[model samples]
Every structure is written in structure tokens, then in C-alpha cells.
Target: MAKYVAPAISLSPFTCPACGAYAQQIWAHAIYVQPHANTNYDVAPLRRCKCASCQAYSFWSKETEAQIFPRAVASPMPHPDLPENCAAVYLEARNVVGDSSKAAAALLRLCVQHLLVHLGGKGKNLDDDIAKLVKEGLAVQVKDALDICRVVGNNAVHPGEINLDDDPAMAGQLFELINFIVRETIERQKRLAEMVDRLPQGARDAIAKRDAKALNGLA
Candidate 1:
């Protein structure tokens, strides 16, 4: 029996997909040192990594330079208002976006539905849910864009609802639209909270007074 040690795995360049963090730790190694005529590399090593930010585990193969299994990372979202299930679904969608556009699109559509439900919007289907968001004050332009996502997602899941090209670019657009909506709602609230927290005592009192008066219908 012989003891084997792999060189420290580089956490640079490759980002942890789950947490959007650059830091990682390797806990195990599998290395193959056989000479091969098919490949140029002399050694093949597979390293197990745990992201420092999210503590999620992934295995990295040196030859492929990629996480071989669970190929998708759970990258952090900008919006605190996004539900946990939606975030997880978004990550899964992102992971498959490069390989399967239809699957990603369907998951992204589900993400939108989860977000709408989390935000107190309800409907029998994704289209109705999106309409509920518009009724709740979502901008018309955003609603129009979301409707496109709804249709695309429906096409992906049901097939032939619409003639879809099934391209990665279209999947990317759905992902981006969901992110935009989350940031617009969740991050905006966080920023506003931060601003209120930084206000001067006198300003805070004045704002509170105004709010109280408004609530009492006296303002």
C-alpha cells in the first residue's frame, strides 16, 4: 500500500456555482497516473471540493477541469425575497442550460411561478400568476417580458404550444428575466431598509410621524 497526496487544488478562476464564492476546500483526492495514448495529460486527478460560502460539495476532475457530477452550482441570488425552492430550482435550471434548453426553460418557468406565489400572487397556472403580478403593480414592460417567459416555459413543458427554436440564448433570457424581477423587488426593499436605517434621528422621527399620520388617515 502507498500513500498518495494531490497538489493543492486551485480555487482560482473557477467559481463555486452555489454561493458565487471563490473560496473552496478539498477533502479527498482520486488520482490516476497511467500513461495513455488518447490523452496528453500524464496524471488525472479528481478532487472533492466544498464551497466555503455555501458548504456544498462537488467533485472536480483535473483532466476535464470541471465538476463531473452535480455539474450545476447553487449560485447566490441578489434578492432576499426569492424563495428557497425557487433559488434551488434556478440553480438546477442554470446547470442544465448549456446542455438542455427545454429543461432549463421549464424549470425557469417554475421559478417564476414560485416567486409569484411567494410574493402573495396566486393563479391556477403560470400565465394567471404573471397576470396577478401585473395587477399587484408590476410594470407593464416587465409583465410583457414575463408573459414571454410564461409562453416559452409552457412550450418547453407541454411541447407544440408554440413553435420554439429551443436555443440556449432563449433559456438565458428567461434566467435573466427572473433575476431582474427578484432584484427589482427584493434588493430594492433591502436598499430602502438600509437607507432608512442610516437616516438621522430627527429625520427618522419626522418620517415615522408622517407614516403614523397617514395610517391614522389624518395626514
Candidate 2:
């Protein structure tokens, strides 16, 4: 997975926001001059940068040094342990966030639903599924994160209290929340199971027996 880093300087090596490749960005400034009736007009100067690794081009304003092309936004890469289906939707959301935050929020909401389903949710209503997971001892922080996505996503799709049209930052936050959910639920549990499996067989059996006795009120 690609780690996102903000480009600091024009000619320095930084992660390519377009393809997430870390490479040297070659920078050049160009100002187009248009002449009419013995008069020359200079257009706004733009700094062009090309990534050495991916050969992708990005434009920046010469004066402000702000990214122009590709509409720079800080979005995290999908978690390594995220399910393939959820990751696909997450990427889709990231792709359109710069254009339409409402659409991105809606896609993230869909990703959240898919993630819950992968975690044994019933594949029905999202609210009901979240409630069930909370009842099943989902972490308080995880539940809260899920609810934030759920509410924002809901508002994105339907006419709701929150307006997502002007809030790309909030939409960006949903990406991190989705990854956090995957880490808390899937990755943590998988790591715990792997640790348990690495224990000696005798120790594993002893733990099973202890758990059984505890369930049976004999511990």
C-alpha cells in the first residue's frame, strides 16, 4: 500500500500524489505570452512537475506554490488487511473525493456496509447491523467511528442535516475511519488468532479447557 505524504518543495523528491510513487519531481516554470496589436500579455505563470518514477505530471501555481492539477487531497491508502471488495469501493471513493465530496461520502458509506458484511453483518440495513455489532461487544471507539461514517454517508446520499457539498475534509476523514475499523475488527482479531495458534498444543488445550469451565460456571 502507498503511504501518502504532502509534497513540500517543488524540486525535491516526494511521494507522487497521483500514483503514490516516491521519486524526484522535475520542476519547470512556463509563462505563455499572447500578443495582439503590438501588445504582449503574460498569462498566469505555472510550475509544472513531472514524477520520475511514474512520469505523471502535476501543475502548481508559481506564486502560491499550491498544487493545481490532480486536485491534491490527503487520502490514506487502504489498510493492508482490508477485504478486497471493501478496498475496491474505498479506492473508488478516494478517486472522486476531489470532484464531488457528496458522491465520495456515498461510496464510503457503501464501503462501510460491505465491511460490516464481511465481519459477519447480516447484509441488511446498515443501522441494524451496526447495532448488532455493538451488542456483540464491538469496541466503543470502533462503534463511534462506524457511526460517524454511517451518519455522514447517510447525509451524503439523502437530504439530511449535514451538507457534504462543501466539506471535503470531512469526507477525507471517512477514509481513515474505514481503515481504523478494519484494523480494530479484522486485523486485530487475525493477529490474536495467529498468536493463539503459535502457542504450544498443550497450552492451547489448557486454554480451551479453562474457557469451557468458565462458561460452565466451574472456573
Give the Å error, residue 68, model 1: 7.2
lDDT of 2: 0.84
Cα TM-score of candidate 1: 0.64
Residues 96-209 of candidate 1: C-alpha lDDT, one tens digit per residue: 777778888898888888877766677358777776677778877668777878888888888665544535577667866776776677667778999999999999999999
Off by over 4 Å in 1: 1-14, 23-81, 161-166, 215-219
Clash count of each predicted structure? 2, 0
> TM per model?
0.64, 0.75
Poorly placed runs, candidate 2 (over 4 Å) = 1-4, 10-62, 69-71, 213-219
For residues 55-145, write the lDDT of model 2, one tens digit per residue.
9888888788788786876687788789999999998898898888999999999999999998878767888999999898989999999
